[model samples]
Each structure stands twice: as C-alpha cells, then as structure tokens.
Target chain A: MKRITIITGHYGSGKTEFSINYALDLMQQGKKTALVDLDIANVYFRSRERQAFLEEAGIEVHSNIYHSDISADLPAIAPSIRKVLENHTYHTVIDAGGNETGAMILNQFARHFLEEEHDMLYVVNANRPETRTLEGAMYHYHRICDESGLRISGLINNTHMLRETEAADVLKGYQLCHEISEKEGIPLIYSCCTEEILIKLKETDAMPVDFNPYRIRLYMRPSWLDR
Target chain B: MSEKQLMKGNEAFAEAAIRGGCRLYFGYPITPQNEIPEYMSRELDKVGGAFVQAESELAAVNMAYGGALTGKNVFLSSSSPGIALMQEGFSFMASAEIPMVILNVMRGGPGVGGIQPGQADYRQATRGGGNGDYHIPVYGPASIQETVNIIYDAVTLADRYRNPVIILADGMLGQMMEPIILPEARETVTEEEIRIQKPWALLGHQDKKERTVVKSLRLQPDDLENHNNKMHEKYIEMMEELPQYESYRLEDAEVVFVSFGSMSRIVREAMDHLAEQGIKAGMIRPISLWPFPNKAFDEISPKTKMVISAELSIGQMMDDVKCAVCGRFPVELLYRTGGMVPTPLEVVEKTKALLEVTK
Candidate 1:
C-alpha cells in the first residue's frame, strides 16, 4: 500500500464507501490518516457528509473550501488537501468523483501526485451499467486516466447490488476484473466484499486463493433502508 | 426482465423512460435530477431517440410540448423551482390534451430553496400549479424500482388519457441508489405507426389535406366550459381507475400514519421500531397523489385513535390526509421543512408521544 491512495470509479460505484473504509483501516493500523473528498460533481451522498463522524474517529476530513453547509454544492476545493499531500507521515485517501468528469478535478493536483509515492485504484462495480463488460470497464478506466492525468496503478473489483449482493456477484466481478488486469497488465489489487458476503464466499471457497479482499461498511446509506 | 442491477434513482428514471418507448426528451439540468438529462444526452442517441438540453426550464417544457404534439412519446424532468417555471407549459399541455410525462425531483423551496431532498412540492404537484382547474395524474413512488415501474407505465398512461402525467419524487429519491430489475425495452414506434395511431397529431397537413391545430384557447365561454367539463370527466375516471396505495400493517393498528415517496420509507422504519415496543402502528402510503388514494384510508383499523401525516414539508400533504380521513379520526402533522429530514427515531418518538396523549 502506498502513502497516498486515490479511489475513482463510476457514479454509485461505491468509491466513497471504499475510500472511507480504506482510510479507517489505515487509522486502525496505527497510521496517521486523512481523507480528502474531491467530488464536486455530485451534490449528495459524498464522503464529506460524514465529516463529523470521521473526525470523531480520529481521521481528518478535508472537503469543501468554505467548510460551508454540507448541503451547499459548491465547486470550491479545499487548500488543506495540499497540506495532507505534502505531509509524508499521514496515509491519505483521495475520494474522487464519479466518471471522467468527476476525476477531471485531479488534473489540478497532477504534479503533486506525480512526485509522490501514490497508488491510483480504479474501483469497478460490474452491476453499474457503464462498467458491466470488459469493453465498458476499459472505456471508463482509460477515460479517468486521460482526464485525471494520472495512470491507474491497479483495479479494485467492488461489484455489488447493494444489500442484494451474493457470493456469485462478487465472483462475477472478479472474472471481469481479472480479464481487465490480463488485458491491460494492471494488477487486481482488491476485491471488496461485505462482511456477510465475505463469509459466504469463504464458505463456498469461491474466491481465488490469491484474491485480496477489502471489507466495507455501507456508511452512506441509512440503517432504515433495508435494501 | 433483465437481471437486477444497482442504479441511482435519476438514471433509473431516464432508462425506464427510454425502455417505455420515449424517443424524445427535453430538459434543463437541475440538481439532484441532473443525471436524468446527462444520461439521456449520452445514451438516447444509441436507441434512435433524440435529446435536447433546452436553454431554460420554460423552453424545455415547450419543446416537450412540441415534441409530444407530433405523436411521439416525450419526457421532461426538473427540480422544485424549475418545475415551478414549467407550470404554464403544463397548463397548456393539459388543456390541449397533449400526451407527455413530466418528473419533479423536488427540493426545498418556496423560492430558490436549498439543494437537498424535500417534499415541499406536494401541494403544487397534487393541486394545480398551473392555471385553470386541471388535475394531472401524479404518481409518488417510494423506491427506485417503484419509480422505474411507474415511469415505464406512465408513458402509455399519458397517451391513453391524452394528459400529461407527473411522477413526484423528492431529492432523496433522485439521489439514492437501489437494486432494480429494469423492464425490457419496448419496440420503437415507427413514424407511420404514430400517424395512424394518433390522428389528432400535427404531423403534416400536405397528405391529409387537413391540418390539426393543437391549442388551449377557446374563444367562446360555453366552449371553454364544455372543454373543462370533458377534462373533469377524465379526472373522475382517473380517480375511479388509477388510485394506488400500499397499506402496511393496518390490521388492528392503534395509530395510522400517512406519507408518500421518500418520507414514507423513513416512516416505514419508524413503524417497525414502534412495533418492537408493543405499539401497533400502521401506514397508508399513497402511490398516486392526484387521484389521492382515499380508498386506503377506509381500510384503516377502527381501533386507530389518531392519523398522522409524516413529510419532509411542514404539513403540505396533511391537507389531503385530512380530506381522506374525513373527520373519522383526529389528524396531526409531523414534519421537518427546508431540506431537513426527520430520522426514523424522531418519527418513532413522535408516534409514542402522540400515542401517550391520545391514551
């Protein structure tokens, strides 16, 4: 794992959820962690909405420049993001917006990323309409790289249908990610699975032996929503 | 049916519209519902459909009107204030009996409210925002899947009645993600088929030697009255045939709650918590806001002591709830306005407090 981990994917691809989980995991491992939200395209369900909760858990959250109302969807980027990028002691996670348009904001910070030891991971959810196939996945993967001016270091298969995800779904996503990795020469870094789905996958022994799995919580969705 | 896939609500509505045979979409971008137009611009062309981002909400609605006048299925979507701007066009379409589908992914507002989820447009949608005494059939879906299903069917429903149909969703519904099995695509109707099916359509006058004039203006007072009566008859038929609602845990419920769209989903969770405490609470979720499903209220358990209207707006939907209850039970309002959403625990606590007072 590199000091700076950048997460990008299609809208509703679980990038925000994965970024939060990855940042917390680093914090739990006794590293100083900071999560920066660079999503200006979406007005709702961004990682910044959980700022107080994340800050309470000892993970510094840097988002809107004004630090205004969370509901205010301004395009301003916070300057503190630069501070986190400059500091070497902290393990930083950048949650970029969805698609090429969302990742376009990263171009402003391209120089810093180029100079630093960083890993840009493209999250893939096969259930999303845009990335269901190898061609579709490759299209988005290339578009994000082109727009962000940053090459993707690896792919993370985080496929799901929210709470309806089964072991078959994760395995199906793995197949797609494997094909992408084989075709592009990029590594399959992680296969994210919810705790329940992870247990099911283990019981069936469906995942590959070398498969790297990341556990995530659905923090964006409220508990009241059953599915 | 295709396999279930996760989709954001706005994108799902756009996909469902295309699958329902809508070949024309005209809309301006507005948050939380911007994905509708964004998806249409990218994907509509692949399916032999056309998408136009009009200069303003005013232009978007008129463009949809012109498109629908040609007998093509037309779709439009906007947020609260944008929908307000399109009211005049809606009135014209309603009076002209134009078939089209409109979506209101509402946000907080009397003016330019915050860009968060809100149901403040309930009165504007259910009642008339446009001039004249016209009522458009309004469908309030609680989930993304339900929104898709309603949008799919609304395309045909609009054509059948020759009136614009509205799908009422809040910012929460437009922004949330859920698993949905999309409906199969409908065969694109040929131009020749449309000409035959919609004889009143203004395609071209050269072939028939007669022109179809689509307008809302009636010069004579009697003529306007007759036209108004005809529209009223159609609304009566809608009330009789199109009212839809879901009654959850109503059997022997001591307190009944009424809500719709995103707010109802939160109220549902509150009901479960109340049940755990040995409190028998139930809900009447109105899926159709226009032909407001008053029938659902009749089935409320006689033991129900009070009826509460839970909403993201301050007592907007309560007016309709009061009419539905018809003084059979005491009615109350529980709400948070201007983009503030009441949590399930808040609803649970409110229900208990009301129950205590009634007891």
Candidate 2:
C-alpha cells in the first residue's frame, strides 16, 4: 500500500467522491487509514462533506484544511496534515481540490512530503468539460503539478455524468484514459464504475478494457438527490 | 476537403479559429470550454501566435479587445458564468465597432450553474448579454462539423460588419466527439495586409497618415447617438442578407420542433424516432439565433398545426419561436434545465401528447 496518496482533478471531476471511497477501500483492504481534506477551491462537495460518515466507519478524518474558515476562497495550509503523514503505520489519503487553484496550496508544504513515498493520483472524469479530450486532460495535469510542485504518479479514470451515466459512457472514458496512460507511461490505477456496469461488462465484451477496474458506489451527490 | 478526424467541439473551435487567421487568443479556464484555451496554448505556439490564459474572464475579454485594435482577428471562449463576466468588454467592442470572434460554450445557469449542456443563454446571446443598444450576431451550430464552418464564417462576418460575432454552442457540443472534415488552413493575415485592409486599425502612425484611435467612449451625447444609429443601420444590412436555418422533413408534417445548438441535434434524433412510429414531424433549426431565420415559419406546410420548442432550458428560446409562429400554430415547450438534457424518447412522447391534446 502506498504510504500517502493525493487525489486531484478538474473541478466537478468527482475527485472528492473518489477520495472518500478510496480511503474506505484502503480500510477494507485491512490497512490503517486516515482521510484528509486539502480542498480549498470548491465550496461544495469536498471530502469533508462526509466526515461524519467516515469517522463512524472507524476511519480517522482530518477536516478544515488549507487554512479553511467561514471565508471559503482563501488558501491556508494546515500543518497538522504533516503529522498524519508522519505516522508511518497509517496510510494517509489527501483529497486535493478541483484544479490548479486547489492543488496549488500544496506548494507551501511540499517540503515535508517531498522525501516521503507518495502517489499523486490524477482523477479524470472524461465527460467533464476540463478532461473531454487528451490535450485538455494533459493541460490540467501540468497545471496541477506546476502549482503544487509535485509530479503525478498515476492516472485514475472515473468518468461519469451522475445518474445519467451509462455503459457506453463508461467505455468512452476508459478509451481516453487507456490511451493517455499508455502515452504518458503512467499506471492506470483501475478505471472506476458502479457495480451495475461490471455486471453489464461481464455479459458481453464489446469494447476492450484493461482488467483491474474498481467498483465504486455513487457518493458524490447533492442532498436533494438523497432519498 | 481533408479526411475527417474525430475531434471534440472545443478542439474544432480552436482549429477552425487558427485556420481562419486568428492569431491572438485570450481566454480563461471554464468547463465545457477549457479545451479551447488548452488547444490554443499548444497549437498557437507552433503558429507563431500569442495565447495568454488570462487570470479571469474579465481580463481575457479585455485582452481580446486590445488585440482586436491591433487589426488581428482575435479569438476567445468561455462558458456561461465566465461569459457573464465578459459582458462589459463585449459592449465596449461593439461600441467601438471592432471586429472579434467570441465563443460561448454555454452551460446551465442563472449563476454558476452545473457544468452540463444548456441553452438558457438564448436570450443572453441573441438579445445581447452586454449593456448596449447593440446586437451581437450569434450563430448557433448544432453539430461538430457545423461548428467548424460557422466559426470559419463568423470571423469574416465579424469583419464584414465591424462588430463582434459569437458562436453560441452548449456544453454537450463542447465535450462530444464527432468526425469532422477540417477545413483547409487559410493564410494568416500579415501586418502589411491588416494595415491596407483596416485603414482605421491602431497601428502606430508610420509617418504616412494621422494617428488612428479605437475607443468606445464618446464624451458628447450626440456622438454616442450617431454611433448607435450607425450600428442600427449595420444591423439592418445584416438582416437583409437573409439568415440561415435548416428545415428538416418539414414537408407533409403536421407538427414542427423549433430548436438550435446541441438541443437541435437531440431534437433531430427525436424526429427520427417519431418518423419510425409513423408520427410525421419536422424541425426548424435556427442557425443564426440572433438574426433568427423567422422566415422559416412561413415555409411551414399548411398541414403543420403545432410547434414544440424543444430546448435545453425552461422555454427561454420559446420567446423567439412564439414570434416566428405569430399564433398561426400552437407552440408547446418540451425542455429540461440545469444540466439535464432532453432525451429523444422523452421528446417524442412529449410531442405526441401535445399533438393529441391539441387535436
């Protein structure tokens, strides 16, 4: 297991959703885990939105990160985050913000984690406006690295369009991510989809997809959607 | 024609702009349209052009205004909220009678709405978003291929009237991929060519003529009024040119769907499904939403008894559709707002229900 994993992507790319579930996935794999919210760019749909649920599941949660306060736009790096990463025994998963504006906050504290073994997972929702094409996806990747002073270690394909997402949508996203992963020489850390899609994939292999895809439950939703 | 390559709408917009002799590009990041600036930055560098990812949409539009004064065809793209921020600059460009090509890859909104395809900006685009007595000739292309062609003409059209022109597309078109035959690259407009063509362009007085000024501010009320009247005359000339719209299967139809942009493409699918069910229907797609091809309504078959405004918004474009029909036919609205697209089946069902009730 990676010592520390940072998840970042374009705004509304569903990085926060992937971050929350990824921490749970770590816990399920029998690893001591802690989730950290370093998102300061977006005011809604941060990893902290589910802090209560995460804590209830016996996972440690770090909230109010990046100098957070009632004023939502300012960037302030919290020093306690380094303490969590230093706890060698536990795996730390930090959910970075939507784009460069959010990921740039890490530049302030890059020194503490520079030597530590960490994987910067660039989460991409192929359907989102920012990652609709290869050039667009590459631009965001470069911007995040330029801002945070960190290199992306892997690519996570988590393309979706909320409840309207379909099997075809899943395949479209996988195709782009698969090509990018090959060209960039980065690992495709499993394409993400709901369990329903997995069942569909099993019935017929119309388009080719790399194995080792992760099944995800939809956790990123507005409160009005919850029944 | 070059072999068709699979291209996203935003990428096609950039490629089309570059081929149209647009060198100076000013843009900011916004969803559904970020690919535009991303493509421009990489591709423009190769063409010896300048591409600045401005800090904000406000700054980007202003930069575009300055670039236009230099007599180069300038390009800029933004989504709904970001376009809202650039309204002031657009107004300035219109008043100065400067030529510019702008693209608004619209998303759902009144404010910072969802990053999904929306046509709520119909009024914003056609009626003019900026504060002014001006109308920005807005072209609404429904497909990726059409986006390329329209952007090609939009540049010339902007120069023809010395006014700002907008390619008003939506989020779906921006993100969707389609095989499009790229147009032949046009020769870039050189400094010498601009100097000769645009006599009023603000290239410093090289001891040949008096200094040229490009300013929107007119201190005297009479001067501003005269300028506004001149703009109205240009608009009259634009209207006389005869706007474009696609009439699909309008003959022998009893109902017609009025729509544009990505929504119009979806409506075409719905029309096909309606045909499959033996429900004869037609479509009137407004290519230029600003000039609004209202004359198409006169071409509707006498058998046409109803019109449905199939839009991506809650009946915003319905206003124009109403005027087009002029109460000759009952017009109903079939729409979904805030990132939810109108499905083909939903539209087919909605049209059938409206037909049944009206009958």
Candidate 3:
C-alpha cells in the first residue's frame, strides 16, 4: 500500500477484498488509512459492509451507496470520497468493481490524484482465465486504464481458489503477475495470501523480497465452505 | 456427457445442458452464473445452437417461452435478482404448460443482498415466483455431478410434463470446481419427432393438419377453467411421480436432520461429528424441493426425538419441514442467513444445544 492506492481488477478477481486488506494493513502499521468503496457496478461484497469494523480500527470508510437500505439501489458515491482525495495525507485505497463496468466509475475520481504520488494496482487472480496470462491481465488492465484515464503503477499477486488456495497456487500466480509487472514497467508491490499460506512462503524463496508482501486474511466467506 | 474433468460447476451444468438437447439459451449476465452463458455462448454455438444475451431477465424468459413454444428444448439461467424479474414469464409458461429448463444460481436476497450462495429462493422456486396458481418443479442438487445430471434430466422432465423445471442451485455449487462424470449425452430433438410429438409446435402445419395455438390465454370462462384443471392435474402427477430425496445413515439414528442442496453436505459432516461423540444422527435430504419429498418424513428414525430443518436460509425450507412433520414430531430450525455459511462444528454445537433443551 502507498499514499494512494486505487484497486481495480476483473470481476471475481477479489479487488474489494484486496482493498480492504491493504487498508487494514496500513492501519496496523500505524498509518492513517481510508477505504473508498467506488464499487457501484456490484452490490454484493462491497467494501461498505465493513465500514463499522474499519472505523472501529480508527480508519475512515466510505461506501458507494450511503443508504442502509439494501433495496435503495441508489448510486450515491459518498461525498467523503472527494474529501479523501483532497487531503492526500491519509493512506487512501479506492476499491473499484470488476470489468469495464466498474472501471468506468473511476474516470470521475481519476483526475483528483494526478498531482499526488499514487499507485493504481491491478489485483490479478491467476485461477481465473481472464487474468491467468499477461494478455489476459492486460486485457482488463488496458481497459481500466483506457476507461479511468488513470494508469496502473503497480500490480499485486492476490491469487486464490476460495478456501482451497495453497501456497503453490499463490506462487504460480505471483510468477505470472511478476512477469506482467516487469513487462508493463509497473512494480510488483505485493503478493498477498492468507496468513497461513503467507507463513508457508516464509521459509521458501517464492517471494521477491522476504517481507515486502502483505498478509491477507479471507474476509468474504460465502456459504458452502463447510468451514 | 462423459469423462471426468476438473471443470467449474457452472460450466459443467452448461455442457450438460447442451448434451441434454438444449438448443437455445436466453440469459442476462449476473455473478455466480456468468459462466453458464459464457460457456453456452461458446459451446452452444459449436453445437449449431444459439445463445442470445437478452436485454433483461424479463426478456430472457419470454424469449425462452417463444423458443419452447416451437417445441425446441430451450434453456435459461439467472441469479436471484435476475430470476425475480423473470417471474411473470415463468407464470405464463406454467399457464401455457410450456416445457423449458431454467437454472437459478441462487444468491443472498430479499433485495440486492450478497453474491454468496443462499437458499432463500426456496419458496419462490417451488411455489412459483410468478403469478397464478402454478407450481414450478425445482431440483436442489448438492454436487457438481448432481448438478450436471439434474440439468440434463430436467429438460426431459420439463418436456414430459409440459411444464417448466427449475434447477435451484446455490452460488457455491456454481462457482466451485470439481471433477465430475458427465451423464450420457442425449441426441438433439429431431424435427420429425417434434412434428409427431409436439403437434402444437409453431413450425407451420404445411397445410396437413389444423393449425395449433400455443398460448396461456383461453378467453371463455369454461375454457380457462378446463386449462387450469389440466395444469393442476399435471402438478398432482408430478407430486406423485417425481419426488426424489436421499436418506443418509437414517435407519436407526436419532435426531434426523432434514436439509437439502449444499447445506446437506455440511450436515453430513455434522452427523460425522455427532457419531464420533456417540450421538447417533441421520439425515433426510430432499433433492426435489417442490414435492417436499414428504415420503422421507416417514423414514425419520424411531429413535429420533427431534427433526431439525437445517438450511442456509432463515427457515425457508423449515416451513415445508414443519408441514411434513405436521406436529407428529418436534421440528426445529437451525439456519444461517445473509450469505453466511455455518461450519460443521458450529452446526454440531447448535444441534447439541437444541438436543439438550428438548431433552
């Protein structure tokens, strides 16, 4: 995570989860953090659901829809989004939804962070076919850049298979994304996985740097995991 | 369908649907089910069939009805909110007694809830989400293999009774990847068979027999009553002939747990835990949620003191459980709502607590 991190990826690539984890990590590091839920294209798993928990951790949170009513379906991006953009002092993570549907919304807020040093990170999941290769990852990356007019400064390897993800699987995604980052000239800022999987990489040489990546815990638990 | 492949659950169902002789698919994009259309658009096209991305679910179902009217096996799929929009078309299809297969990759909902799997559409699927006194035959499958088999079999069942069939699967079953042995593929419905069987097909009579009218409308009071009675008779036949359920370790166990779909798999785990602790527990899983599989209710163990309706919804299937039990035994509900799935240990703890209170 950086001064300002805008997270966007293909649908089911887990962008919101990445954004939530990055914001929490920044807060744990004793930095002022804020997560903006610019996910108007999707209703489920929006970052807004964790607002109270994030606020309890002493970080500000903004939702795309302000109404507590689920049926409201109004496109009210929190006014706080603009406020967060203006400040630039607090670590801000803007969570975008999947596909061009989600990236198009970022166009409105993309111009705000041009003056600041920002990293719009494309979270790539290798398990999905769309982001499995450089071409697949670039398809959405180019579209997000084209739609938002905001360049992706870095890439994050956030591979998963729901609860079935293993360390090897995450490593496979990291290798693929690392190449994409290198070819595209964007830095590979992080390779995220659950603390358990992350711990597996501790003794291995899978990571680019020993302690550079963030340890992410699974936040969205859909039914049928048998847990 | 044959040979095992580690395919995503949604793609498995789509492939199986095509093999089941489904020629046309009309659907809109929604999470947990996008793979169905994605796979269908690619594969169905290869089979010399068509996949049309409809403007809306409302349009999708109507397009399905139009396709099915021509006596071609048509398929359509959508998630909760999208399914909600297709209710009216479902009703009209039922009134006309048209044959079509629809898959509901269910999501959390009373409104725009979570994208995670939830069994909240139990009533909407079984009891009919659309208007009129109609019953949509719904199958709640627990596995990818079962999902493939059901999607394959559902097309024929829908055609057999000339009624719509809904494969009510959750997002977990749709999103998870699993190796499955596909069912033997069924040949595409031939035009000759359509002419002989579905004489009501809109594929022009060729001046041979009287032109047919395929519609739900019968303006006259007597005619409409006759149509309704005919549809009702088919539902009764479905209830009598199409009740399919599973009874697991249920012979002499106590505290029979009644569950369905993905929730039953977890309950099986909970049953294992109970057995390890010397608590004999069994399960009655209704594969077909509509007919309620009331027969499984009679198989409740003699040692059973409580019938637990464990599910992912806040007691949606419990209503049917209570009805089936009909006060003959104490029926308890153990459920988790809002896309939250309970673990096997959690279910065991809850069951033990309920058992203690009942004791």
Candidate 4:
C-alpha cells in the first residue's frame, strides 16, 4: 500500500465505504492515518458523516470547510487538508466523490499528488448502470482521470447490491475489473468482498490467486437498513 | 429476471422516467436532486429524448407545460424551494389539464431550507402550493426500487388522468443506493399514437379538424366552475382507484405508526426493535400522499391504542394522519426537523415513552 491512497468511483460504487474501511485498516496496522472527504458533488452519505466515529478510532478526519453545517453544499475546501497532504508522517486516504464531477475537487491538490507516492484506485461496481461494462468503466476511468488530472494507478473491484450481494455479483465485478486491468495495464489492487460472500467464494475456491481480497464492512449505511 | 443493478435514487428515478416514456425533461439544478437533471442531460439525448436545464424553476415548469401541451410525456424535478417557485406553473398546469410528472426530492423547507432529507413538503405536495382548488396525485416511495416503480407508473398515471403527478422523495432517498431490476423501456409513443390518443392536444392546427387551444383562462365564472368540476372529478377517481399503502403487522398492535417515504424505513426498523421489547407496534406506510390512502387507517387493529406520525419534519404528515383517523384514535407527532433525522433507537425510545404516557 502506498503512503497516500485516493479512492474514486461512480456515485453508488461504494467508494466512501471502501475508504472508511481502508482508513481503519491503516490505523489497525499502527500507522497514523487520515481520511479526507473531497466529495462536494453529493449532499449526503459522504465520508464526513463518520468524522466523530473515525476520529474516536484515532484516525484524523477532514471534510467540508463549514464543519458545523453538515447540510451545506458549499464548495469551500478546508486549508487544513493541505497540511495532511504535506505531512509525510501520516498515511492519508482521500475519498473523492462519484464520477468525474466529484473528482474535479481533487484538481486543486494536483501538485501535491504529483509530488507524492500515491495510489489512485478507481473503484468499480459492476452493478452500477454506468460501470457495468468494460466500455462504461473505461469511459468513467478516463473521464475521472481527465477531470482530476490524476492517472489511476490501480483498479478496485468493489461490487455488491448492498445486503443482496452474492458471490456471483462479486465475481461479475471481478471479471469486469480483470478485463479493465488487462486492457489498461493497471494492477488490480483489491477485490472488496464482504465476509459472508468471501466465505461463499472460498467454498469453491472461486477467487483467483492474483485477486487481493479486501474485506469491507459497510460503514456508510446504517445497520438497520438491510437493503 | 434481468440482473439487478445498483443505483442512487436520483439517477435511478431519472432512468426510470426515461424508460417510462418521458422523452422530454425540464429541470433546474438544486442540492440532492441535481443528479436527476445531470443524468437526464447526459443520457437523454442518446435515447432520443430532450433535456433542458431551464433558467429557473418557473421556467422549467413552464417548459414542461409547453411540452405536455403537444401530448408528449414531460418530466420535471426539483427540491423544496425550487418546487415552491414552480407552484404557479403547477397550478396553471392543473387548471389547463396538462399531463406531466413532477418529482420533488424534498429537503428542509419553508424557504431555502437546508440541503438534507425532509418531509415538510407533505402539505405542500398533498394539499396545494399554488392557487385555489387543485390536487396533484403524490406518491411517496419508501425505497429506491419503490421510487423507480412509482416514477415509471407515474408517467402513465398522469397521462391517464390528464393531471400532474408528484413523486415525493427526500434527500436520503435521492442519495442512497439500492439494487433494482429496471423494467423494460416502454416504447415511445409515436406521433400517430399521440394523434389518436390525445385528440385534445395542440399539435399544429393546419392538419387538424379544429384549432386546439390549451389555456387556463376560463374567464366566465360558470365556465371556470365547470372546468374545476371536471378536474375535481379526476381527483375523485384518483382517490377511489389510486390510493395505495402498505400495512405492516397491523393485525394485532397496541400502537400504529403512520409514515411515508424514507421516514417509513426508519419507523420499520423501530417497529422491529419495539417488537423485541414486547411492545406491539405496527405501521401504515402511505405510498400515495395526495389520495392519502385513508382506507389503510380502517385496517388498524381494534387493539391499537394510539397512532403516531413519524417524520423528518415538524409534523407535516400528521394532519393527513389525523384526518384519516377521524377521531377514532388519538394521533401524535414524533419528528426531527431542520435536517435532523431520528435514529431507530430514538424512535423506539419515543414510542416507549408515548406508550407509557397513554397507558
């Protein structure tokens, strides 16, 4: 894993969930971590919603400039984010919003990203209408890259239909990501699978050797919402 | 069945509208629901549909009116304040007897309220926001899949009744993602189909038997009364045939909750928790707001003690719940307004207190 990791994907592609899990994973590894939410495109369900929870777990969280007003859709980026970007002591994960429009906010930090060792992982959920196909995934991948001025360093297959996820859904996303990795020559960094689905995959040894499995807990959605 | 696809509520609603044969959309961007217009602008053209980001909500609703006048399926979506601005257009469309579908991805309300999930527009949508004597059939979907279904069917419902239809979703629904099997796209209505079905439409008069005039100005009092009476007839028919709701565990219950849209989901979770604690709780989720689904109230068990309206706003839907209860039971309001959402635990706690007090 790189010192700085940037996660970007379609709106409902589980980037926020993955970013939260990734940040916690880094913290568990005894690394000082920070999660910066740069998702101004969405009005709700951003990583910032979990600020207090993440901070309680020893992970520094940064998000909208107006911290008090959670509902405000202001585009004002906090100046403190630049501090975390410059500090090499902490491993940082930047959770960009959905699509190229969401990733556009990252353009302001392009110089810092260029100077740092970062892995920009394009999360792909095959169940999303926009990224279900290789052509569709590539279109967004290229568009996000163009808008953010950052090339994707890896692909993450994080597909699921919320609680309805099955092994077939994960494998379908893996297939799409595999095709994209082969075509773009980008490494597939993670195959995010829920524990239950992972058990199902392991029953048949369906997962390939190269697919790095990343177990993700759905932190973005409340536990009460089964679907 | 086709593979289920994950989609945010806004984008899914937009896609469902397109598939529902809405070939023209006019909207102005606002928080939360902006994705509807964004999706429409990006995908509508590819499907041979037209999308216009109008100058304002008023302009967007007017554009929808203009498109619907030609007997084309038109879609319009906006948030709270934006919907408020489009009230005049809504009133005009209702008076003019135009058929179109409007989506209110509601947020905190009254003025330019916060950009968070809110159901304060319950009265605005179910009652009237514009001028006198109009009722738009409003469907409050609880989930993304339900939202898609309602939006898809709303296209036909609007056209069938020759009146505007409203799909009331909140920011939570607009931003949330869920798996949905989208219905097969409805074949777009051909020009010939339009001519045959909507003979009253104002297509070019050159080839028509009579010059068509679509206007709301019935200057004569009797004529206006007759026009209103005709429109009220459709509302009556909608009340009779279109009132839909879900009754969950109402067979034997001490307390019943009446909620709609996203708030109902939270209430459902609370019901489960209440059940664990030996508190018998039930729910009536109104899928249609305007028709009010008063029949569901009759299904409440005789054992039920009190009815509660749980909402994300300050007791807006409680009025309808009270009307439906009709003095048969005491109705109370449990709400979190100004962008605050009550957690399941909060709801459970409130229900317990309410039960104790009533006991």
What DockQ, between 0 and 1, does each candidate earn?
Answer: 0.77, 0.05, 0.10, 0.76
* Candidate 1 local lDDT, A49-144, one digit each (tens): 888889988999998886536577688998889989988888999999999999999999887785458999999999988889999999999999
lDDT of each: 0.90, 0.81, 0.82, 0.89
lDDT (Cα, tens digit) per residue for candidate 2, span A38-115: 876554445665777888876787757533233243455566777777788888899988789889877776765654
Scored by Cα lDDT, where does model 4 land?
A: 0.89
User: Tens digit of lDDT per residue, candidate 4, span B1-359?
Assistant: 35688888888999999999999999899998988998899998998889998899888999989989989899899999999999999999999889989999988876897888898988888888889799899999999889988999999989888889999999989988888888889988888899899987877877556678888998899999998898888888888998899899998889999988888888989998999999899999999888889999999887789999998878888888998999899898899987788899999999888888988
Model 2 clash number: 2
Residue B264, model 3: lDDT of 90
Between candidates 2 and 3, name the one with more favorable TM-score.
3
What tens-digit string does per-residue lDDT give for candidate 3 at B26-98? 9999877887898888888888899999899888989999989889999899999999999999999989889
Predicted candidate 1 versus true structure: per-residue lDDT over B1-359, tens digit per residue: 99888899999999999999999999998888999998999989999899999999999999999999999999899999999999999999999999989999989988998888899988888897999989999998999999999999999999999999999988888998898899999999988998889988887887566568888999999999999999999999999999999999899998899989888988988888999999888999999998999989999877889999998888988999999999999998899888888889999998888878878
Badly placed stretches (over 4 Å) of model 3 are: A65-73, A195-214, A222-227, B1-60, B77-97, B105-124, B127-135, B142-149, B169-200, B207-241, B246-254, B261-282, B311-316, B322-328, B334-357
How do the candidates rank by lDDT, highest first?
1, 4, 3, 2
**Candidate 4: where is the Cα deviation over 4 Å?**
A114-116, B207-209
Best by DockQ: 1
- lDDT score at residue B217, model 1, on the 0-100 scale: 99
Docking tier of model 2: it is incorrect
For model 2, how does the per-residue alpha-carbon lDDT over B216-296 read when each residue is reduced to its tens digit? 888899998998998899999888683889898899898899988877777777888889999889999999888889999
* Residue B142, model 3, lDDT: 90
Clashing pairs in 1: none
